[model samples]
Target chain A: MNTVWKENALQVIQDIFRNQFFDDSLAITEHTTPADIEEWDSLAHVNLLASIENAFNIRFTADDMANIDSIAVLLATMVERGAC
Target chain B: MAEPTHMLMMAKEHCKAGEHARALEVLRSLASRHDPLPMQAQYARLALTIAQGLEGLPVLRVAFLAGSTLDHLVGALRFWLLLEGFRLEPYLAPFDTWRQEAADPSSGLYSFRPDLVWFFLTARDLKLEALWGDQPQQWQEAAAGRAAEVATLARQVLATLPATVLVNNAEASATRVLGNFEGSVSWSAASLQRRYNLELAQALPAGASVFDLEHLASCFGLERWEDHRLWCHSKHPFSLEAHAPVAFAGAKLIAAAKGKARKCLVLDLDNTLWGGVVGDDGVDGIRVGPDAGAAGEAYAAFQAFAKSLSLRGIALAVCSKNDPDLAREPFRSRQGMALTLDDFAVFRANWDNKADNLRQIARELNLGLEALVFVDDNPAERALVRAELPQVAVPELSADPADYMRVLAEGAWFETLTFVEEDRSRSRAYRDNAARNACLAQSSDLDGYLRSLEMRACWGDADQARLSRLAQLVNKTNQFHLTTTRYSEPELTALSLADDAWVGWFSLSDRFGDHGVIAAVVLRFRGQAALVDTWTMSCRVFSRGMEDFIFLKIWEVAKGRGCTRLEGAFRPTPKNGVVATLYDRLGGSSVQQDCGQESRWHFDLVAPPPDLTHYIADANGSGN
Candidate 1:
């Protein structure tokens, strides 16, 4: 269940970031963080989370919103919550 | 305060001359902190006039409260509304304030009192979290619970606020938990969104409308619609590219809401109405109906749609550049043709320029050119009409023959907020007027013609049944209206019951047919004088001595009330100048040559009314 959810969540996140950066070659992985992307600021982070919530038809709680700082943490949260 | 009327026209001229910056400066000088005009239509037209060639229009007071960041969407909506002759001053509520603004009358939404209030909330704002890890049954329950909250808010707004509330349906994100198989499950996002929309629609009261944002996003494609970058930065769900289409839908709805809907459709023939030009292809050779290929079928479908418009009360007319007989032969002879000669109120198939022809049609129908929507398949003809007669709405048609019907129908120019029984019979009335014109043309002596046609003016008090029609006349009649003061139906009803006021409408019918209520008069008794508050007559009855008949009726009513004098005024508008000499012709002694914008006249009721004895016989049913 974790593997399928993680894979789907990772794909949705990567699609959003790629469009954001306007670079089809931009890549994402478990370790990717805001420091890895120059355009990833606090404003961009909220927009990213909102887009993911809409695309995946799920929501992030206050705890999940604060704790998810990287791609791996975000996907893990979705997988553990069964939201992907 | 609003700018003077002359200044507004000067700014419009500057815009027409392509001095957009100058026009903007002119408009800015007239800007007020409050709503500029007392009348909604006047404000809309003024905004449209000043906004020409400008990047953004004068923002009307519109409170936009939605779940998503809608800066770009509002920009697009504002521009689109301006194009459709509206400029909304958008008051964007803070995020998550939709409920608070709607439920509380003391909120900024009510304080601002926007002409239009738009609410756009996404699934996340409602039940996204509740649906997570939920089964089909659980999903249904969550959707129902959330939708009820939205409905309750809508009801509260409808009760508390006087603005038109526009609520957008929720759009499901492209990410599907169940993928393609989600359709089979009730727990799916699509299912939740659909149910939410249905419930929301049922909850909306009158004065509230639904905007299908989901369908609009689909038209723009879901992939392009959801911009994660913009959404992350600003919470804007829609991309910049999607703004035009989104704005267009909202603008069209607003135009209809304000009763600025186009009234008449002036069509062209040959390549426009059929697959081929009738003059060149001959009557038998022209393609129409389903049997003729795809193009012919499209033309036939178009005719059927035009026929439907006629039935719905939209006046149909023809202004084609063709021989008269050839222009009308297709409608008369073609078995597949959906429309007939009688469908059109005016048929002008001559070598005259289309602009002149359109003017003639407007005159014959007693309609303003601003009320006309000209449709032609020919680009050159369309361009000519657009340039020469700028007031007439000339929509550009697609070059493809098969696209003609869809292009014109999708415009939805003939929009209406309310439908009346009289709308269905509007074309028949115009047809009757055409018959009257035919009789007038054949007669040599004008009096003999009027006498031969058995005419009767039925005078009666305007009751509740005729209030809507009377108000429409008051609002729309321009050419023959003296003191053109538009009134609402409720206002007219109040006047009818007022002790000092009297309101009456007259229906004119001749040997040809009934012209419906062709004249209306409003009088206010002050001391020994009856002030003619309003005297509006349909231009169709011009030169038919209907004015004389109405003058006589007004005299009788004034005398009955023991008033010694009947006072009248003629206020000049661009179209109403035709009635400038009306009071003079009625034999009223000039009281004031200029009372600001209007000229005043009065008649002594003790002295007899101008030689209307000839009309007395007709009023008593002797002429017939």
Candidate 2:
């Protein structure tokens, strides 16, 4: 994988997490839960899915956006979708 | 802990957490709290009213405000009512008796509170007619009289209050609303500033700036509100991301009210402005008669609506893919045609691709492509224009001509500020541009073209006569622009007066005709670096290299002032791809590369590009 793509992927992950969580200092981990950040409410979960899709220039199915709950699950979904 | 304050905090938390339904539930519970203190009751009522309004629950909003609560609730109700499309008169009716009682000073209402009296009187006066029924003429007259009396009382209260007191009152009472700022920062900022100016003039006292809730909202990517908890929690009431219709409507209103309304409505004729293709239908076969038939009536109605837009001062132009003579015959000969050839400012009826035809129309009208809203019923045509001329607002229209009028009316296309004098003169200005083009086409050499047409370029500050044109160009010009910067009218005014900014516009005319203010250049001086923030030339003079001439003049001014570097930026937009290579061709080196950094271009005055003979030198030895 290209180093730039790896960096961009991490940055995209960070942006999605920060915006969804409203914690600028948020460090995206594989185990982060929706409840851990006060700002990661139901609406932010959907927004995070959409942002990730846009950053990766891919489409997320309704099921995909709805099913993902944790950062680990989201990352797995992205990997399954070949987004990273 | 007080139940109402506790509920308020919970609701605030839910609202911040993007759980609008949960927030609304908490607010409802707070409002239903039994027999609370007067202050608590008032706060609860206000909170419920705002929350219900945000939730799009008009019934709940009305119930909370109409209750026998404190008088401040009346003011909150009035604002919410306005937001929900109810006129001011209906919302202020219940406050009349309180105002009269307060006037006596010893009355029970006066003993309760002096501020409440003012609020009651102001609300009543502001909305008198709606309180009193419209049926009885005598009652209506009485309501009007009371309204005037209440207005006087409100003025007295305002006059009695200190400046600081009024400011504090305004700050506390100001409603927090959301809007879309989707375009350039200059355009958005100028529009907000204009609204700030107007709000200050109408509601706020002098020196008060309308706080930009939109800009504040944008700090959290509020433009994409599913990302902003403030918006997602408000039930998508204020964010462009969640509610594009509402956000676009808010932005359009702000833009229109500031007299920054777009200049031209570039329309596609066949199946768009009219029912059938003129080439096939011939003038008579076109569905444009006042007959009772559905299709015929629809076409006639659409034409009438298009014509009515002219009365509102929106210039209509045509770009049709048909023979010019055949396409134009309907306007002149059709029995029920409402929009005539004279109604259009520019008409490009040729078998050329619509995108090209639209480009010609923009050039002939001396208006910016961004100022145009192209309406074509054909999806393919709309898509082609969308791909080719992305700057043009080509709204999708139904193929069934019957739906055209309603679509135009309901869609925020024709919404604008007050129609000014220049609007009526727009059609004639395009006619002049056509003549100028014809003269230019006749000449072979550049100098011969300039001399034969007797073209004179007037450059200076925009006066009252030309300010509107200058504003339109600033807001709309995209292609051939050094930087496609959009500005509202008030921002243009500010730029004209700013010491560091040199704003100049040119009106070019030859013996054939007058091209009304077809070019504008805005230069900002920051210490030693001079920046060409906005440099746009009308598309009509694109091949003429009028921009090179303008840049030469700008360079002279910059050189004379001892400026070190002449910096200009070409922001690569989907529509401005034509200008992507402009800086490179003009001898400016790129200093950065990124999504947004594609716009930055810099030129040092120490090195000048090779001179070209394209520009004709005016008698003063300066290229005009």
Candidate 3:
């Protein structure tokens, strides 16, 4: 993974969690799953993804969205798509 | 036991810990105990997290009756309302239930008894195929048919409920049936939708509001807003991206419904209103008004925007740490300046602290600090007001002067659902109030000042034309309201029309200018006695003997209506302490005294008080 892209994406994701979930202590890792955060429900997942797209100024295809559920896959997809 | 303030602090900690439900519970408990810092924006921020799950915080019941799917909208709206320090309980009608729910009073939708109803109809419901078909003769028929249907629905809703109804305009479909020829077709989908929205707006009664969703959709870009996958999956119309903006817009309308709209826009002069400081640059060097430069034009545009806001009834005030004469120079001498000295209700241009100046402005205008929006380019000054007066909204102005207007408008501090004539003429009225103050300062004593002003008060029954303003006074007047009961226009109108109700409005004018509808009195008759349900007056008219005059008028009205006795109550709220001794001043005797909540007072109307009527001219234009 590109460390710069991963770091940038993680910072943006952290802000989204802080704002949307009131999770100021939320620290995203490569292995973090939806189960790790109670507020990472379906509605919030969509909101988080949309916010990420806005932050990066990139559009994700349906296939990319369907596969990018986990942080590891999200980072890989961002790298593949050159979003950061 | 933790103090209420400590509980509020703990609630903040709970919110930060992602225990939003607990945070909300704590906040609610604090609210129940006492008013929990009502104007604190931080509390509003905390509400966003758990509002979707939590219920019962003085809900403004809203019924969503729609033609298309609206499940995606309800949660979004609830979240935004909560974020704006409001609780909303949504009653969602089944899909395609707009016509049925609007037409029938006994429909399941009426069970919620919504304070506001939103009609979310789409282009699909109009069956655009019939309008855009090859049959050219059928275009007029199709258009009329759609218009009639929407008009019928509007009428049914108006007749059925006293709720403020918002009808969403149909957005044009991105799909092109006629391809390149779509622009030429008179009854194309876009044209039909636009026409329908226009007709619907005209057809809706005065109480019903049109949401203008078509314009909003266009602004968001039609293609990006309508998610095909979501539509296919769950009949969701708006994209996930559009949720916040749409919800915020709806919440603005809802906030206005509850009279939570901010009133005044207090401005800072140095580097905020003008590009350069008046003290440092001098009047000629400052970048304001015409032909100064790009920066000057931007400042000029900002002034024009502020002027427009004043015209919309938002009072303007200036709080600057400069010489009063120096501050007056730009408005006095500068060419192409949109704002004038008369535009502002109060101007504090001394070296006093900005927050203290803001408080002075609030006191002079008889407005709450919560109603004030402080706009200062200086981050330090904004921080000062935010710290000292937490109730005042200090919006962070952009570094770029050009973006000031956009930032202020987007802040949505003064978002109101209805803009009556009273709002449009509010600035002029306040300017007139300044004249009255000047006259008062010049006079020898209280009676001398009152008699010198040549004040004329036009008293009448509160009718349709004045109903909205009466309700607005009831909602916003805190310090001077005797029994702070907020009512909507419909409820106020119903009260005005009731046989057992006496609704009186007082419009006072002097040698200076007209203070339109300065006071409102609502009385409910109980056999031979009358109960003062609502007695509210503007703070601007305070100590002007307007209160005494209105009290006498209320007594006369009750007597004329064959009521033998009159009663009034003072309800204790965080803000209404000023009116606690109001009944005592009116020569009223204590009747039903509640230790904490309310104190009721009774007055026998058989004999009136000695004439304090030297100030106001009679209703028939007869001078005192």
Between candidates 1 and 2, the one scoring higher on lDDT is 1
Q: For model 2, name the residue pairs that clash.
A: B453-B511
Local accuracy of candidate 1 as per-residue lDDT tens digits, B411-463? 66786544555677778888888888788789897888888878777887788
TM-score pick, better of 1 and 2? 1
For B32-73, candidate 3 gives per-residue lDDT tens digits of: 211211212234446555664455456778888776556446
By lDDT, the best candidate is 3
**Model 3 clash pairs?**
none
Q: What is the C-alpha RMSD of each candidate to the true structure, in Å?
A: 11.3, 19.1, 6.6
Winner on DockQ between 2 and 3 is 3
Angstrom error at residue B313, model 2: 6.7
> Candidate 2 residues A1-84, lDDT tens each?
445655667677986676444356888766778777776755455456656766676655556666788877876677678886
**Tens digits of per-residue lDDT for model 1, A2-26:** 6766676678788777644444578
Better structure of 1 and 3 per DockQ: 3
Off by over 4 Å in 1: A1-84, B1-18, B21-78, B81-242, B249-260, B490-503, B519-531, B555-567, B589-596, B601-624
Candidate 2 lDDT by residue in tens digits, B337-423: 788887887788887898888887776665667678887788989889988986677665776888877666544655543334445
Ranking by lDDT: 3, 1, 2
lDDT of 1 at A38: 89
Docking class of 1: incorrect
